[model samples]
Target: MIMIRVILIMLFGRCLSCAICSTFHGWIKKWIQIS
Candidate 1:
């Protein structure tokens, strides 16, 4: 049970990081397009 919880936490962290990275990239792209 503990192992499963740990794996879930890791996956959630990875997904959160990916979402943040995508959002940052999208913002940068918008700024580049506007410039």
Candidate 2:
């Protein structure tokens, strides 16, 4: 059970980081376009 929970947390963290990275990438692209 504990192992399952740890795996879930790791997956969640990876997904969250991916989302944040994509958002940051989009924002940078917009900023570059504006400039």
Candidate 3:
């Protein structure tokens, strides 16, 4: 049970990081377009 919880936490963290990175990339693209 503990191991499963740890795995779930890791997966969630990874997903969150990916989402943040995607958003950051999108912002950069928009900034570049504006510039």
Candidate 4:
């Protein structure tokens, strides 16, 4: 689980400046929870 988050961070780290990043992060959290 930690590794998955780490990989996601690496992939999304580049877009941290974007407003949508937070939304995408929330979605990811929800998705993880659902799974």
Tens-digit lDDT track of model 2 for 1-35: 99967865776567756876567557768999999
What shift in Å separates residue 33 of candidate 2 from its native position after superposition?
0.1
Regions more than 4 Å wrong, model 1: 1-17
Instruction: State residue 1's C-alpha deviation in candidate 2, in Å.
Output: 43
Off by over 4 Å in 3: 1-17
What C-alpha RMSD separates each model from the true structure?
11.2, 10.9, 10.9, 4.1
**What tens digits encode model 4's per-residue C-alpha lDDT throughout 1-35?**
99978877875878875667777788889999999
Model 2 bad stretches (over 4 Å): 1-17
- Candidate 1 — worst ten consecutive residues by lDDT sum? 16-25
- The estimated TM-scores of all candidates read 0.51, 0.51, 0.51, 0.51
Which run of 10 residues does model 2 get worst, by summed lDDT? 16-25
lDDT of each: 0.71, 0.71, 0.71, 0.81
Clashing pairs in 3: none
Clashing residue pairs, backbone N/CA/C < 3 A, model 2? none
Candidate 4 regions off by >4 Å?
1-11
Local accuracy of candidate 1 as per-residue lDDT tens digits, 1-35:
99967865776567756776567557768999999
